[model samples]
Target: MSDNSRLLRRLFDERVRDLGLTAAQARLLLSLDHFPDQNQCFHADRLEIEPITLTRIADRMEEAGWLERRSDPADRRARILHLTGKSRDIVDKLQSTVEHLFEDTLRGLSATERDTLGKLLDRIGENLARAREQEPVHG
Candidate 1:
């Protein structure tokens, strides 16, 4: 892994460890928690992960009382992920850490610079997604 990636991963993991969750657990909850006006409806297939892996992660979170899974109203076969009350509480706390981290990580950047950095990161994610979609699956 790149030095910056490894550094950020450890920084994030250490900051949120008190929530009694792993890095992956925090990610799943944070993703769902981020859906403010989107009805908390996320298509599991939209994530870059394999469908089976996503399903397993969702199942694990559900078992951990972090979330609940239900069939999507529009798509009976597709599962919709929702944060449970327990998770909602933790998510609020987690969001605080996320927000603080954002501010701290960019402490050296001005507002405009922070905005530019965010835009660049978004573009990188877009490029990565496009690349993944074009890649062939290997067994």
Candidate 2:
């Protein structure tokens, strides 16, 4: 837990909350933006989240109009999640603010330093992801 990104996320969450979106709703929306090309089906196995937990989260998002769960066209009965217009603008604003905050935070860093930090951060994130993948999911 040496990672300090939680503070950044908290700030982002506050901003989103002010705009009428819960943190989870905002994240679900951003996740959609992350895979703009992919249709509703997110590979639950690849996300390293427990299927049950992800299902609940997705269900909540769907309930809030942030997204909808529908049968995958290629595999009917397999639920695929998709974002709706309800969350689109709020998500866009959150993303823009995140980008601006990132740029502002790294404003003083030289290009080489930024590159190095990016590489290091990516490595650290991969390590964390791997660790999380190994942890048993508890209901």
Best by TM-score: 1
lDDT of all predictions, in order shown? 0.75, 0.74
Task: Report the number of clashing residue pairs per model.
Answer: 0, 0
Cα lDDT tens digits for candidate 2, 1-139: 3455787777777777887777766666777778753433363454545667678777877787778776667776677677788877877888987787788768899999999999999999999989999999899
- Minimal lDDT window, size 10, model 1: 36-45
List where candidate 1 sits over 4 angstroms from the true fold.
36-47, 122-139
In Å, residue 21's CA in model 2 sits off its true spot by: 1.4
Q: Give candidate 1's error at residue 80 in angstroms.
A: 1.0
lDDT score, candidate 2, position 88: 78
Tell me the TM-score of model 2.
0.70
